[model samples]
Target: MNLDTGSSDIWVPSVNCETPPLCKSINKYNATASSTHKQAAGSPTFNLGYAVGGLTGLRATEVVSLGGLTINDQIIGEALSEPTDSYNYPFDGTFGFGWSIISATDQNSTPLDNLYEQKQISKRLFCIKFTDQTQATQDAIPPGGELSIGGCDVEADYWRPLSVDGFWQIKMTKLEVGPATDGGNKLTLCENGCEALFDTGMGPIGGPPDEIELITKQIGAHFDKQSNYYIITPCDIASLPNVDFQFGEVTVTLTPKDYMLTVSPQICYTGFSKMNTKYQKADYLLGDPFLRKLTVIYDKDNKRLGFANLK
Candidate 1:
């Protein structure tokens, strides 16, 4: 069992098989509660078939304990050949962490897919807020506080403070490109709570139409022949001013030179890009790049996120 601050899932490269596997954790029950359309209260979660390349079904709890959980217990994931065939995860297969019974949306708000607004940690999609051991992760989640199954305390803030602003999950208010000085459109900010979903595994920035269009214009980037993604010149502009994240009156300047987000080295020019299509109510997906800039605290209790900049 290994520990990855990235997506959650118990990947026992030894035997889980490549065809499919079972719920190594509690996400099963949680997902079952999502849309039990059936009157018998069928399990909301399911025995999702994942392609873990050449691995085995490693129990989630087993992995957590094996890794000597000190903080932010590790969640097992599936390993695949394509690297993006998450069937469920483009970042590979992840343990179900977002379920109606235990998500913020299930708590009262509506849930997307199976991620409900009920609890903080979803037993089904049990993913952790990964940070680069890259000097950004603050006091890790006390491994002793490892969560499993339906275990949770609404009043409990298992969330510890990170060195950075705990990856601020701010709302995308609006975006602008280029340097009002250089006259390039290069920005993607959020509204009140950045309704965008954060996925560390997927490509850097992807979202609905209007947003993607604005970013491409500012960064001097273009769409790939594939028409699904964009490409731009890679530069040492990590710390450039064109890339800005606005949270309230607080406008964050993501200097690639100082902080690297998106986790994709190919995106030479650092700027924002919107996902041309809306998957649901969610607009954007905060990729690894933006997350690496700060320590993201998934404080499920209060139903709000926290972040702190280590750089």
Candidate 2:
């Protein structure tokens, strides 16, 4: 599971039987990794609906061998078991190839090859295609598909045809701050420079900043007496907001529905969770929320990401 990303932080889960901490636990895991000078990390405690029983990421060496890499510098621990629900993530575990570099023997080689030749992190991007047809939790995920980073193998993914986007990268135009509606007149979301991030480690695209700035601007422009995240369903305005996605060849238009995080009013900024200001550079990461939206084909061979809308 070698990926070409700037960050090399690995993730694992902390085992706190009762009243476990999610993000805090991951912080602790990072502390441990930093001390060893190893880029390893533990995920916060969580569950996959049933029992916490997925992830089970292989060590760096194991993946190299399996993926037919010439080098084996990576070190992966067996996926450990733990209770979920603390980290706000539904799945059990994640395998991060964030720092994985391609081996000479690897069939799919991206621009990262120049780096690997120079013994550096490849400047390539990758994405994972969640087999929604075979979607499952740690307890019930069907052994149907496999995930490919630098190349594709029927054995790696349970589904076939290998429909994928070449390299995982997109140009973000802007960010939309607020107003979530189902039809004609309401709120919206990240419109400008809102590039989608894709990663196995992240639970969802986390937003942390003066989120209220975005939310309030769009949301406040319309309804007056609603909470921060949710746009007031003004009876006066009988339509949904026009959700917009801007791509070169494809323009995705989704009617604004209730914010994904409809439950919390103030927490609308994150829609899931939040990151600090320093970490607020990237836009809607292609996290769980993202994978669920499309069938991402990662061509490590050519360093391209293929995108297909799933039915």
Q: Which candidate comes out best when scored by TM-score?
A: 1
RMSD of each: 10.7, 10.9
Number of clashing residue pairs, candidate 2: 52
Off by over 4 Å in 1: 1-170, 180-194, 226-229, 233-241, 256-280
The backbone clash count of each candidate, in order, is 87, 52
TM-score for each model: 0.49, 0.46
lDDT tens readout by residue for model 1, 22-130: 3232223221232421211222221222212223332222212222222122233223222232333312333333323322112222112223223332432222333
lDDT of 2 at 295: 57
Per-residue lDDT tens digits for candidate 2, residues 1-311, read: 22323223233443421234333343322223342323323342222211112232222222223343443333333223333443454433333343233121122322234325534435332344554322454458773334543433332221222122321345544443324432223434454445454454554344543553444344333322344233333322223343344444444343233224233443322223344312323454444443554556644444444665532
Stretches off by above 4 angstroms in model 2 are 1-73, 77-93, 100-127, 131-169, 174-196, 211-213, 216-242, 253-274, 277-281, 300-303
